[model samples]
Structure formats: structure tokens, C-alpha cells
Target: MRLNIKSSILFALLVSASAINFSASVPDEGMFPLSELHKAGLKKAGLKISEKDIYNPGQIGLVDALVRVSGCSGSFVSPNGLIITNHHCAFSAVQLASSPLHNYLQNGFVANSYEQEIEARGLTIRITDSYEDVSKDILDAIAKTDDPIERIAIINKKKAQLVKEAESKDPSIKAEVSEMFIGKTYVLFKYKTIEDVRLVYIPRQDIGEFGGETDNWVWPRHTGDFSFLRAYVSPDGKPAKYSKDNVPYQPKKHLKVNPNGVEENDFVFILGYPGKTFRHRPAQYIEYQQKFLLPYTSELNDFQNQRMLEAGKNDKATELALATRIKRNANVMKNYRGKLKGLRNIDLIADKQKEDKALANFIQSNTALKAKYGTLMSDIDKHYQLVFTDAERELWFNNLYTGIRTYQIANLINKLKIETAKKGTLAQKNEYFNKNIALVKKELDAVYESYNVDADQKIAAHMFAQAYNLKDKNVIQTIANKNFKSADAAGSYIAQNIANSKLNTKEKLYNEVLNNAATLLAYDDEILKSQQQFAHEHAPFNQELTRREGVLNKLMGDYVAVKEIYQDKSFIPDANSTLRLTFGNIKGYSPADAVYMKPFTTVKGIIEKGNSGDIDFRYPQAIEQAWLDKNFGAYTLKGTNDVPVDMLYNMDTTGGNSGSPVMNAYGELIGVNFDRAYDATINDFAWNESYSRSIGVDIRYVLWIADKIDNAQFIIKEMGI
Candidate 1:
């Protein structure tokens, strides 16, 4: 039937509005697996390469170039196993390799040759070899178990067996079975682990961590958060521990870096292991976070960071030791603060409830769906209510145990008691004791290195004050009442205990505590007694919470299956530290009214933000001179002649995605994904395309630092530039 001109215009408007609404609602979502990229609408999203070009189990692809760098992501930039990742990803190694004289963390390091590369002890890199769907195998193994706990045990056993068989095939291969969509699907990932990793190059802290906490998660970022590491292997090309005889391992595929750099609206994609996200979680969870969890956590994190900073002041060794931990805590605190703000700004609970209502209406319209999925949302809400009820006590117990040294000592003592109770021969018992004693001593040494009695005491006092002020009936208040009249008195008592305790020193912990396990077990201390009482009081709540979580996971798994069936929509599983591909374009965002954040920031921003008095803003003299001289060399942008420091993209990312390779349409390395904008931290809970933007260190800035500042020509040549 033909329509009138006016009717046709109205119809066209309706269709256009519908399309815009759909686009706005969905955003550029999904952290798809390599095999599912095609189905994820990659081509329609402007992917110029085939899915196979990014990942192929049977052949070398972009996946081969990716590596899991400790807890972060990295990509091979050279055939000789040179990897590029965020400097913060390698921060621990840098700190470990630093000392009063060398101070790698402050000065950075540049290896002119392979021989000069410093060994990164305890660092390992893993490359994905293969992955396969193991959902049926896991489901079958747990099919007979109706109890959630028993089902988990059965699934874990099956997973262990699978990993054992896979690893037994090759000693160098590490295997893991990761559950996706709660438990609806499972995939076994096999990786070739290279243990001999070495630090190749790192820019100074002034460049690497520029602007520090002040500019973290903010736009117009100028941080050159990039570093290089090389993977080494034995003579026969097998993974081995650090050795003098080891050589740089050759990778099957390495990314060809495009030093020419990317412009705004350029197609960008990322392949890495994202840590976690709760985009599919029920509305109750969002409500709980908004009302309670995020604010409380942020407060605790702030307290802890302040204590650490106060303790580390004027002590270089202590500062170096606490640097990594302080950075982590500060990052988390900022993230929680951002998340809380974003949650309130977006009215996430109302939006989630609206979505839930629509889903419920759809289910109610169909008989089978009504019967199968009608109670899912309510069931989730019910479980969340229980969680909220026990959260206060749980928070108290967790904070006391985590922040107090005495509580940790109590745990160690209890572990030692359990070890002594085990049945074994005298020699075997002695062997176990010696082995465990070494471990205990190592742990005690680390604790002592970072621990400050005054700081811990202050933290303990704060915790007690919080519990007392809230009139919490938890063990914290009970202990406070028994030991002292007020939180200040409680703090003083804990401080005295910390100062007098033998556990304060490693030598005392070993010779006095470890060598006399029986004596330690029989000893009575106020801190230890308080820890025991706290654990006893919280045990039931902890057990119930675990059971509730298991049940909730199963329910969520069922809900996912039902939604997929009824809605006929693609259900990408929540991230669980597994490899996934997310694609988007370099784009700016409007964070607030009339405030447009451009996708890219140049070196000019760095200079503008620089302050010689602040360590974070201070640059090396060479870098300053080069910038003044306009020595961008080949790293300059074509028309503007400016070196891009960082760029923003709309790709989905999380914690572990730091250092992830930001690639062009053809899968060439262009940047490194490091941090997301502050307003986008809520992407973990819910994604709003207008606010969710991930930032990356532009490759051109990295090269500019290498060539113009550090004069690392050999490293540049090694990339075959």
C-alpha cells in the first residue's frame, strides 16, 4: 500500500529514531572471543581484516603476538620476542630491580644490547597456544550433583584432570579451564609459558608516570606509560628459568608497529585478557553498590593510602618498597570514587529496573518462558538482600584482618598449628616444618619491609572507631570494649602489642616462633585472642555467604540460558580473565555539558601540565630540550607536526587489559591501552557509550622518547623500523 507524502516523512522519522535509540542503548558492546568476532558484527563495525587474520587456532595470527605479562597484557613488537606493555604493568619488576644506588624506578633503564638486559626475577610471560569449548565435559561431570557446593567440587575435579592431561603432554604448556556466563559455558585455554623474562627498556618515572595520581583516569593525559621486555628461552627453544645461557626467544608472529600513528575516528581494536565486568548483573546488585559498597570501599582505600604515604615519607627504601602497593591502592580508591559518581549521574538503578521490566514483560507474554524465567529477577534480588544484611560485619572483619599486622600473625600461627597436627614421620614432619618455616620467614620479611607499627595502629584505631560509632555487634567492638574504654585506648594497646611482639622482626619470627611451634600454639596474646574471637563470630556469616554465592551463580547461569533462548540475542559471557577481542574507533566524548574531550592529546599538553617542583610533572632535561627544539623526528603527526602522547577509544576494557595492544584495522600495533576515563570506570558495572572511553599511550610518543630522548637507536633498529 502506498502512503501519503506526510505519512512517509513521519514513517521515516520513526525508523530513524528507532535506529538511533537502539544504537544508544547497545553502544559498541561485547568483549567477543576470537572465534566469535565475525558474529560480533566486526565487519559492520569497520573491521578491514578477516577474523582469521586476528586469531586462528591452526595458524599464526594476531593472537600469537599477544602475551599475558604477569597480571597484565602485552604484545610482541619484534621477532626476537621484544614485548611492549605499559610501564605500570612492569612496575613491580622495576621496583624489585631498583636499590638506593641503581634506583631503576626513578631513573628507568635502557638496555643497549641483549647482554645489558636485566633479568626480571619471578616474571613470566604466556602466549596462547590453543583453546577449546569444554562446556559439555564440565556439565556432564557435575550433572549428578544437585548441591551447589558438591557441583563445584565435581566441576573443579574435572577441570583439574583436564589441565593435568594437557600439561602432561608438554611441560612448557600451562592449561586452565575458565567458566564463562557463570557456568553456562567453559573453555580450556592452553598457553606456552616463558619463565625467563628480562627488562629491556623503560622510560624515566617523569615520563612513564607523568601527572601521577592527580591526572590518573582524567582526560588530556600525557603519560608515556610504555615499557619493553624480552622473553628468553633455552638453547633448544624451550621455556626455562633465568640462565646465563638463555637467548631471546623468537615468536611465531609479532605485530608490525605503525610509527606513523593514528588519527581521530581511526578504526582500533584490542585483544587481551579483561579482568571482570558485571554488565549482565541484576538491578539489585547495582543498587547495593550505589547505596553501600562503593562508598565504604573508597573510604577504606583512602585511609590505607594515607597511612602508607605517611609511613613512607622521608624514607627512600620504604617509599620504594611501598610504591607499587600505594599506586594500586590509590588507583582502586580513585576508581571506586569515579564509579560511585558515575552510578549516581546515570541513574543506573532506574535504567536497570526499566530493562528488567521489559524482559519480564517479554517472558510473561510467552507460556514456556513465563514458567522457566519468571522468578529469576526476584530470586536474584532476594539473594542480594541477604548479602546486604551480612555486609556490615563482613566489612569489619575483612578490614581488621587485612589492615592489622597482629591479625595476620594470628592467621599464620593458626596455620602453623594445623601443619603440626598433620600425621607424618618425624623426618617428614621436620621437612614440612623447615619448608613452611622458610615460607613464613619470607612472608614475615616482606611484611616487615612494608609494615609500619604506627600506621597499622592508626588503621586499627580507625576501624575500631568506625565499628564502635556504628554500634556494630561485631568482634571489633567486642574487642574494643574488653581491652579499652575507647578507640584511642584500643589503638594504644594494639601499638604496644606491635612494638613488643616477636613477630615484628623476621629473625624473631623464625628463631622464636617457627622453631617453637608448640610454644607458639600454647602462648596467649591479646591480639591473637581477638583474631580467634573475630573468626569464630564471623565464621557462620562467611559460610552462608559462600553458599549463597554458589546458588546465585547457578541461578545466573540458568537465567543466561533462558534469556538467550527467549530474547534471541547474543550473550557474550562476562569477562573472567580470559582472552577476548573488543573493537571500536578512536573517538572523542562529551563528559559534561558543553565539555567535549578530544580523542587525542599531544606533547604540548605534557609541557602545559609540567611543574618542575612536582616529581610527576618533572621531565628529564634532555626531554625538555628535545621538546623545545621540536625534535619529534619521524614521530610527528603529518599535518600538525605534534607528537601525540595519548589517545582515547571506545573499546571495552578492564584492569587486566592494561598494556593491551591497540591495533589498527589491519592488526598493526598503534598504541597501548592503559587507563579508562574517570567517568567511564562504571563500564565495569554498566557501559554508556557517551561516557565510556579507554585511553592508550600513542606509539609515536613511545618512539619519540626512544629516539630523541634516550637515544636507544639499537632498540629502534631491532623493531626493523
Candidate 2:
């Protein structure tokens, strides 16, 4: 007999007999969990080394060498904790260490000794120590809660308890509860976090990002996108924050660099923390992304990029301060554009809709299946309708408050007021109030440290213009009341008001927050009033959206359960920024008919792009001279006289996989995974072996640059080349 929804919804939705079978056919998909490596058929897929070499759970393996550098991935290259990651991953550190007199971001940075290595502020690296399945604990705790919100609350409490229990065993360990399958499976991953990370090497901007945005996600790339950092610990070999007393950390395992890169069709694999993917989402979710999310986000990012460019055009300090933000936004903006194009090119939504229809038919054809999942399709569609109804208005209001600092401060103040007035126990209210108050102060500190009024005003103006042009202008009561004649007028009005506000500075706003909390909600600033109006208008929708998300989470879990039965296979869990391994071979694809792309690119391509006179393609002078002189070092391939710059493979990777080590069959580092082919940006939605090609900077290129251009032979020698 089947169980009722009230008793075992999550349990039934998760652990069917078929789902328990881990040994499914090894498809060219999935960011396989470390625990699942034995079943991943790595050996049959040309892994020359044993599976234990990659992930030996209780003992140290290559997995211990992997590091999550903030949001990107890296690998320890030496016993003393030398790390190799992408240049963009280390760009912020270089920016922090740069100035007009010593511009490391432009001229490059190289530490001659450990004493010279600069501290990388706010940079932390976490190594995965262990993970355990806690699905039964989480699912059983919430098994009886039928109310969606209450069920979610119970889940959170259970996850927190598990994490706290895990972290209790070691002070240096940081524990996280990752949802492997939404609302179904959970895992507790423990990490050893290193806080005293320092910058070791970074090439000049021209050499590091040779093609810039123009070639960011395209194939046949020629960017030497690599950098190095070192992790340090206290004298007693414990994790500690940056200090003069800290010594270099010595890891039990480190990846050995292979000077000779891969040949065509040689096997390669990446080990890193990959971010989110939505392959199993329903048709309506795909529709939402295709119709609303992707385009909207891309356009907003582009607008912000252009505004920042205009604000920093002449000021060198402003330019340097905004460089990281601009580069990050442009990267996302272009990636989203690629994803949107891929969606339309493949008609993903239409295909998903047809599949949904087929699933509904299959369910209806069987009495038992119909009784279990009769309203699944209709229920999912209903929730999506709620999401789509006010998405535009909500998106505009979200950007207004988040993109502009003044509005962000106003919103925080409003939140604090609400928190203060809430009816709760003294301890509860104090904890909540303190948290909100800290948030307000942090925002203030940030604004005081780096807020650019000109840039903020321009961004605010652009956002107001966007809001005014929306079909439902009443979503923002302030703009609606103004009745501006045109988008330009709307933009100019907001900018002028922001410029004239007395509470624009951090000191003034923070004073109000600290001294005048009782009357803070009624602050007289125009921007504050407008922000309150936006909050009032958006509150109902936000609440309903939360409830809808909870409901959909449960429904999607059930849908996947039934869908797996229908498909006769269990799908790989979507990536949730957990450490995973993906393997493929070194090969290329045909982006268009009659045009086959080669797997490898050489320094010749870099010089060719530089000759075009595009600043984005400019190479370093030493690179050009080295090419002209035919000064190929041992880093060059054995058979070919040319030195390799970048290579392509068919690996499954996403956002957080940046800077991951591209390892050859022997588990040696051969390249650094950075970008994906333009056609492969759709891999997040659906993976196609023919078109899903990932790009990485060849290790040979990194050695050549470190040896010939930057003269950092110490780094090469340290790698034991």
C-alpha cells in the first residue's frame, strides 16, 4: 500500500528501490559526488590511476588538495600550500595590493620570497575534510509536518542541529548542510578553512585576460588565465586570521604539475566545487528563466556596466576601484546572453512542455500513478502563475533597493523598525534586533569606505528610468505620483533628489540609525520615503512568494520521484556548490556546419589577435617578442614547435568550477578550468555531448609565462618541474 502525504511524503518521494541503486549507466553528465566516485566508472573512462587516488574518504587524497578560494576553485601545488587558480579568481587581491605608484593589477605582481607576499583581504580557502549523509535525520524530523512553511522550518532546525553537532568535534572545521535533491536528500560536509591566504603571483591584465569580454566564453581561446596563492597557518599549525606570525600551511597532498600538456582526445577530469544547475526543473521553471530571468538580469548588468564605465572614465582611482565590479558584471552579463541565445536556439521550453505533457499522460494512464500524482502538473503550473504575475514589478523594485546604496540603507532601517516592534520573548527580540542592527552598521561602513556618489546617482537614475518604462508604473508609488513626462525626466528627477538629500553620507545616515531608532521609520528623506513605499507595495507579494516556494519544493520532490519511475532511471542531483568530479576527453566540436574547432590554441593565436589593434586582445610585449624570437622553452609540446595557450574538452562545469584543476589520466595537473564554449553555456540547463565543451588554460602556457615573461622561476622550481 502507498503511504499518505501526511505520514511519509518526503520519505516516499526520495528513497524508492530504483533511486537506491547507485550504479546507473555512466552518462556524460553529472557532477558526481565524492562518495559516488566508485560507481562513476572513472577507470573505464581512461582514468589510469586508482579511484582511491582521487577520493579516499578517511585518508587524504587528491580531494584534500582542492580548495574553494572564496567562490572559485583552486588546487594546492606544493606541500607548503602553494595554490593554482585562475587570474580572475585572484583579481581582487591584486586590486587590493595595487596603487598608482605600484599598480600590480596592470604591471603584474610577483613575490620574490615569503616575506614579500601580500595579505589578501577577505580571501579564505576551505578544504573539504569529510561528508556524511543526513537525509534520514532531516526527512524524519519533518515527516509529519503537512504545512509547507512549518515543514521548511523543521528542516532548517534539523540541518542546523546537524551542522552544529558536526562542528563540535573540531574548532577549525566549518560544517555546511547541502541539499543534494531538493526537499529530499541532505548531506553534511565538513571543511577545514584556511583564513591566512596570501597572494603569490598574478600576471598583468593584458597577459591574463588577453581576449577580455570579446572572447570570454567563446572557443579557440588564447587567455593565460592562471594565478597562484599560498595558504598559511598559525605557528602551532592551526587555522588563524592573517598575522605576521603565521607560517605556510603544509597539506598532506598536493597536485604535481605536468609540463607536457594533453594530446588530442586524451582523457581529462576536473575536481572542484561546481555551483547550481537546473536540469531537472519542470517546464514552467524553464519558461520563467527564458521569458523573464535571463534577459532581465542581462540587461540590468549591462546597464550597470555602462554607468560604471561613464563614472570612472577619467578618474584613475575610481577606475581601479570599479574594475573588479565591472569585470564580474560583464562576465555574468555575457554568460547570460549566451544562455538566453542557447535557450532560443534549442527551444528548451517547448521541448520541456512536451515532456511535461507526456509525463501527465503517462500518469493518467495508470490508476495508481494517477491517484498519487494526478494534480502534479496542474499544481506546478499554478505556482508558476503566482510567480509570473508580479515578477516584473518585483524585479524592478528589487533592483531599485539593492543596486542603489541609499535605498538599501532605507530598507535596512525599515526592517530594523519592524524587528523592534515584533511581539516576541525578550531574548528572541534582542537576538533578532541585534542582527538587523549589525546589518545596518555594516552597510554604513561599506558606504563610508567606498561609496561613489556619482556612480550611485547614475545607477539610481537608470533604475528609475527602467521602472518608469515598466507597464505597471504604480509598482513604485513615488515614481507614479511624479507623473514624469518621459523616462529621461523620471531618471533626472531621481538623480537630482539623491544629489540634494542631506542624509546621503554614511555619517548622517548612521547617526539616524543609532540615535533616532524610535522615529527612524519616518525619516524625511525623499529616497527613504520612496523606499518605504516600495516595501509596502512589495510586502504581500514577497510573503506569498515565500509560501509558494515552500509548496513548490515539496511538489517538485514528488514530481521527480514519479518522473524517475517513468524514465526508468534516477537523475544526478543538481549541483549546490558542493565538491564534485566531472570527467571527459580533450576534444573539440563544430559550432557551425562545416567549421570544426581544434582542441588546442597556441601563442601564435595570441599574437594574431594582438595584431588586430583591439585593446581587448593586446598581449604583453614579452609575449610578442618571445614568439618572434622562436624562444619556445621546455613547456612547448614535444612534437610541435608552438607553445599551447588554451585547450578544449567535453567536461560538465558551471559557475563555481572556475579555476578548477584540469587533471590528466594520472591525476596530474595539466590545465586550469576557466570558461566554457559559447555553445556549451546551455550545459546548466541540459548537457549535450556534441556541443558541451569546456575551456581551460593549458599548464604549459602557465609555465611559459612564469618562466619567460614574469621571470618567476622560483614558482616554476617550487612546482618541482
What's every prediction's RMSD, in angstroms?
Answer: 7.7, 5.0
lDDT tens per residue, model 2, 278-377: 9988989988888888898889889888888887799878787778878888998888889998999999999999999999999999899999899989
lDDT of 1 by residue, 523-546 (tens): 556666666677776777677766
Which portions of model 2 miss their true places by more than 4 Å?
Answer: 1-19, 22-27, 412-442, 447-450, 472-474, 481-486, 502-524
Highest lDDT: which candidate? 2
| Residue 163 displacement in candidate 1 (angstroms) | 2.5
Tally clashes: model 1.
Answer: 0
Show model 1 residue runs off by greater than 4 Å.
Answer: 1-27, 421-431, 469-484, 516-524, 611-615
For candidate 1, the per-residue lDDT at 492 reads 68
Clashing pairs in 1: none
